[model samples]
Target: MQVVIGKAITYEQQRLIKIVQKQLSEIDKQHLKELYEVTRIKHEPKDFSINEVKREIECGKDIQSLFQLANTILPQLKISNESIKYYASLVGYYSVYKLK
Candidate 1:
């Protein structure tokens, strides 16, 4: 499904964006990278089961580590890239991270 991230962002939304981007960038797992790239290229949200996210984190990297990487990358998407919240919100919810 398509997510609308181009909606004007508020300051609180900016914080949320920063957190997710930071988390995404800190992730070190190959699978997480693969999943992220897939989502990016598709321009769609990823549909990963919690178990899958857990497995990718447990087997390759810690979930929080991946989240931290996300936090770093998310905000950059707005300025230097396309709005990834559409794709990222899927990852955030999949990873069970609360976005404010």
Candidate 2:
């Protein structure tokens, strides 16, 4: 019975992780799209892939690592530290939701 309950809990956690991943992906897509639009309007579009950045974030990279990646791809765009923190927080949330 205990083994069955443990398996059930693990399964539920996996399900939640999938659901959260989907939701976070959608949110990141929308967020990146909006940022891209703004940058385009300013005639300073960065040559970066939103999907790639999202993948890196989802892979549990540290916030410093994210900033490093962002700096490499978006040197001209001044991304505030607060904004990085916000993105890091989202990654942290996703990580928590992905626990099994």
* Alpha-carbon deviation at 24 in model 2, angstroms: 0.5
Q: TM-score, each model?
A: 0.28, 0.27
lDDT against the true structure, per candidate, is: 0.49, 0.48
- Model 2, range 1-100, lDDT digits (tens) per residue? 9999999989866865565455444545444444322222223224558965664554444334434435544433344678657855554344332421
Model 2 deviation from native, Cα RMSD in Å: 15.5
Model 1 whole-model lDDT (C-alpha atoms)? 0.49
How many clashes does each candidate structure show, in the order listed? 25, 0
Q: Which segments of model 1 are wrong by more than 4 Å? A: 1-61, 79-83, 89-100
